[model samples]
Target: MNTANPQLEGLYLALAAMNRLMVEKQLLTHEEIHETLAETEAAVMKNSALDGQSDSHRKAVAFPIRLLMTANEAAERGGEPTFEDLARQVGRTS
Candidate 1:
């Protein structure tokens, strides 16, 4: 889906609501949320520079979300999960 598409606004809102709920329920810490957002923004910026890109922002946003999902899944599987793990999963090595 296009990240800038107005039709997807509701989806973004819903996801934001769910994240807020997770914070309220202590399912995610404030630091984790902040780091997640930071990583997302970074992905967007990185992907935005692509030439002839049609949906760079959407693709960029998906990168971090995918990383988050992977980290969550790993954690659920009793594996060690960290922001670095998510970053690595998203190919954000430095």
Candidate 2:
């Protein structure tokens, strides 16, 4: 797949792997990750609005949180989903 930046793709992979390990190690539950990401997304969206950021900007800023949330959801479902899978889900559910 094409990406604007390769570094960003690497970052996403690293983050997803960390999240999976965290869940697997029982360091943090999926519910906790989901809740935290939800709260973060809300805060980012609100800040974006208050700062008069564009809709696209808001979505861009929230992308990582949404990706993590998607990963957590997939983990909760007992599936080792790919970054692409989580990314697609994030796009669909955004």
Candidate 3:
């Protein structure tokens, strides 16, 4: 990742580092992160949070989250699909 795109790699690393810092500072814990992810997955799975979001907004948020979730699952099974593969699998393109 750092080899293909330093800027993107830096951003990802920085965000992860910040998240780790929050845990180190006791501002948040992995348990809280897991809970949030579960709650978000529930809401998004049912599209229960579309009350105020426009269709475009929902797709914008949903697509990426869905893509990442799919990737995460695939990773658990020792799969490493490229971003292009993930996009197509998720029925999305940019």
Report, for every candidate in turn, its global Cα lDDT versus the true structure.
0.57, 0.83, 0.56
Error of 2 at 34 (Å): 0.8
Listed in order, each prediction's TM-score against the native is: 0.44, 0.88, 0.48
> What would the per-residue lDDT of candidate 3 be over residues 10-76, giving only the tens digit for each residue?
4533444554566668887655644665567567656745577665666655664555555544444
Residue 29 lDDT (model 1): 64
Task: Rank candidates by TM-score, best first.
Answer: 2, 3, 1
Clashing residue pairs in candidate 1 (N, C-alpha, C atoms within 3 angstroms): none
Q: What value does the lDDT take at residue 13 in candidate 2?
A: 74
Q: Rank the candidates by lDDT, best first.
A: 2, 1, 3
lDDT of 2 by residue, 23-67 (tens): 889998888888888999999999999999999899999998888
Candidate 3 worst ten-residue window by lDDT: 8-17
Best candidate (score: TM-score): 2
Cand. 2 Cα-lDDT: 0.83
- Compared with the true structure, the alpha-carbon lDDT of candidate 3 equals 0.56
Q: What is the C-alpha lDDT profile of model 1 across 15-37, one tens digit per residue?
A: 54566568668899646866776
The best candidate in terms of lDDT: 2
- Residue pair clashes in candidate 2: none
